[model samples]
Target: MKQSAYEAAVGLLSRRDHGEKELRSKLLSKGFAFEEVTDALTRCKEYGYLDDSRYCELMLRNGINKGWGPQRIQQSLKQKGIADSRIQEMFLDLDIDWFEQARVTAQRKFGSQVQRTKDRQVEMKEKAKRFRFLQYRGFDFEQSNYALEQLSL
Candidate 1:
């Protein structure tokens, strides 16, 4: 038997939280007609079964737990179709300190003795590598530099 649009949407939501855009796209991709998908989404929203803000908050917490930086998390949220204004608002309401998160991430990746070596050239190379790693992990230059300093001390 074919599932109704509402049934399919509920099934999907039962497994994980989804942003409205993501849920709409997923339902459409599953062969539901646009009108059916829209109805399902509207119903879901009305019943509080789908919420972009809730999804964003969950994603943010998960990203932070995984040591992701704010830039990286922002990019991920954008890719998931979250609005920039909402992202900014959510970030403002969040209590996380990005710099502290960066510092912890650096220590976790490089360890406490990250700067124990005394060779100037080798130390420079290590610092450069660490900086690059942090940059790639989505930290800005200032945040990366701060993390490196914290790791070195």
Candidate 2:
């Protein structure tokens, strides 16, 4: 009369997408044996129900919406157990244009005030803070610099 591990896994997956490691861990925590969890995971993969590539795409789209830069995206995916090789292949030549994105984000958060500062020291300090914010959003050094420069103009 016991429910199958596969059934439980399917129910969990139906609620939301999960990375492989996360799924496996959840099932194990729920008392499913390792073999059963592995079998269920394999079936999920066979049915195209679990795919890191799809996960990557979803993460990328979500990151774009949240104004996250490529470096942050890369780190996030890696944390989800996505392979480095796949990450490179998937993101190679990907151009998210962090500079322009940063400018837009800055404008939305702290628009003309950034440009209106007459004190050179205060202006530079504000600019540096803005640059740090963009960097924290996962942009690289060059992208952050370009974004801060564009905002000044």
Candidate 3:
């Protein structure tokens, strides 16, 4: 016997949290009827099994823990079918200090004090390297600069 959409959805949710949109997509791809998927989604939401906000929070926390900046985290959540508004709201809810996060990430990656070199070219190279790292980590200019400043990067 074929499993119902709700059963499939519940099974997926039991393994890990999934965003509403992601769950719907998965169910539809598995050949469940559109209506069945919709009904299953509604039921899941009603049962407090599927929640975009909750899923967003989990993703946000994961991103932060992994040292990702706001831009990167937002991009990831968007790819996972999370709404921009929802991502922003959850970011606000998290009350993260992005500048501080950058500093922490820098300290974690680089040492507490950057080694100074007698060569001006080497110092410039070191600064550029560290700045690029922060930028790639999704930090904005101001935030990156602040972290670099803190690290003497």
Candidate 4:
């Protein structure tokens, strides 16, 4: 699987844009030597063919649509080798009201069920469960609780 630098770079671009680290990792996995991969990665960066920030922005939108919170999104970007500073800048730049979004999402998922509860305790528990679900969906505890409360009202 010896791919010429141009071939590998083009192959990568043909699929989707990749962050430098991700692109390099893929090239290495494809058996490109370290120096070659580095050169390819540098070339990609120089030509503006790859951008971690753009990747973060795209992933952020996707994560939000899928009902994820900032912490979860940040953690994921970090795992992809994105810098913390850039992650912060992008998160802030996106200017998302995460709580409101999560609240809306929770309401959509469980609003009808709230009306069917037979007891306050049971309802509270159910709401808590919904909160936990949002947490798993990448929301923080505070955001989850706030979302549940908003929907409960």
**TM-score per candidate, chains pooled:** 0.94, 0.88, 0.93, 0.88
Which candidate's lDDT is highest?
3
Clashes of 4: 0
Global CA lDDT of candidate 1, please? 0.89
**Descending-lDDT candidate ranking:** 3, 1, 2, 4
| TM-score of structure candidate 2 | 0.88
Cα misplacement distance, residue 77 of candidate 2 (Å): 0.6
For residues 2-23, could you state the per-residue lDDT of candidate 4 as single tens digits?
Answer: 5587578768877987777777
Clashing pairs in 2: none
Error of 2 at 97 (Å): 2.8
True-structure RMSD, every candidate: 1.4, 1.9, 1.3, 2.0
lDDT of 3 at 24: 92
lDDT values, one for every candidate: 0.89, 0.80, 0.92, 0.79
lDDT of 3 at 48: 98
